[model samples]
Target: MNRGRQIGISVSAAVLSGLLVYGVYLLQLRQIRLTETAEVVVPRQFVPAGTALEREMLTTLRLPSGAVTAEMITEMSEAAGLEASAPLGGGEPLLRWKLDKFRLLPRRGEATFQVPRDYVKSVSSGIRAGDRAIVYLSADGLASRRLFDEPVIVAAVKTAANQEIDNPKSSNLLSMAEGDKERMYASRRDANGSIDAVNLNLTEAQWLALDNACKDGAAKLVIAYDAASFGGEGETGS
Candidate 1:
């Protein structure tokens, strides 16, 4: 073929290829716009862990139906009165996993008590709100004995400075699994070590037991990740 014919053929091929690519792009854009959407609950402001979800704390957001996951909180009622299991940023979708376990609220004669700063610090970093832990009592500062016959669920982990030890640099101890060490280190840091208190969901009888233990001696809280790990004293199972 002549050079002119060759050049014309190449130009035609280039134009056709461009049109095909542009056509595919438009098709994708159209499909995205056609996707279904659903109203979902998301945080309107920063929601701290252990805080009860209030109406003002959340708002509805219309999101693509495909983006919804099984863990997401679809209804406002499901999130209402539920405590956050972890810190949630503003505009973040509310998820069931982010909230503490749904349990009956404190009843008459029952109260939410704050665990002492020292006691909170003593517990492993793996412990969080909704975890079951056993409280121990130390009479002479020499040893601690288990005070509770069974574990009680940790209602909330509160800090005096409103911050958990979440920064890696702030953590001085390392006992978590290799997979969790990096995350545990990333916990919020407190320069004053003011990650102070933890709330315990205790019944009247349990509260009285703790009070009696405190009166008799110092109380130390321990979280056992496994029941079999509690064979020895002073050994905490993370």
Candidate 2:
């Protein structure tokens, strides 16, 4: 009788331990269910100028907690019906898509111009987000320095009407014909119309040259292609 009682007690303890282990496993399973994977929405198209995109137009997508990675963008673009390899516009397109992906946030800031409009004419107006520009500054009152020959990364043409040329829709200064250019020059020379204030992304040296030229009252601008020239040392022929 004593042996049987000891055996019964051992069996009861083992069963209780098994039950506790099973309960803990069930709790973990429930926790995982509570944190199920969810989908998010991303942009599919490059919204062009004059097109209105609403917050509701974005398509929702699903991504697991550990699934977001660098390559996931390509996958997301494919799933969102957008060409994963398509090139995006320089500033606005990149910004809009990045915002859609929740990768980058958007913020507004003023583009300030160091030169006044009476000096440069709104030549910066025609520039777009992706267009290239050659910033020129009068060099010693004889020629002009090509401060920058790179493409315009972000154009503030929209602001051309305002103090900073904020409006992107304004016509570019380089697009003017000879006649138009003459008229613009005449107006600026007369000082009766607005000054030629333009904004550009330039290096520190270029900025310094522009400022100096403006102060010296001999600054001018010209639009041209960017070129690189290499020269070798030469000697006088006999």
User: Could you say which candidate leads in lDDT?
Assistant: 1
Could you give candidate 2's per-residue lDDT for residues 1-238 as a string of tens digits?
Answer: 9999999999999999999999999999877866666554455545433222344334555556455455333333433322222333322122223332110111122222444554452253233322335556554447555656553223333343454332224222332222254433332233222324434544465556556666655665553222210011111110
Badly placed stretches (over 4 Å) of model 1 are 1-110, 118-121, 141-143, 164-194, 216-238
Which 10-residue span in candidate 1 carries the lowest summed lDDT?
226-235
Regions of candidate 2 where Cα sits further than 4 Å from its true position: 1-72, 75-114, 121-125, 139-141, 149-154, 159-197, 223-238
lDDT of each: 0.61, 0.40
The top-ranked prediction according to TM-score is 1
How well does each candidate superpose onto the true structure, as a TM-score? 0.39, 0.35
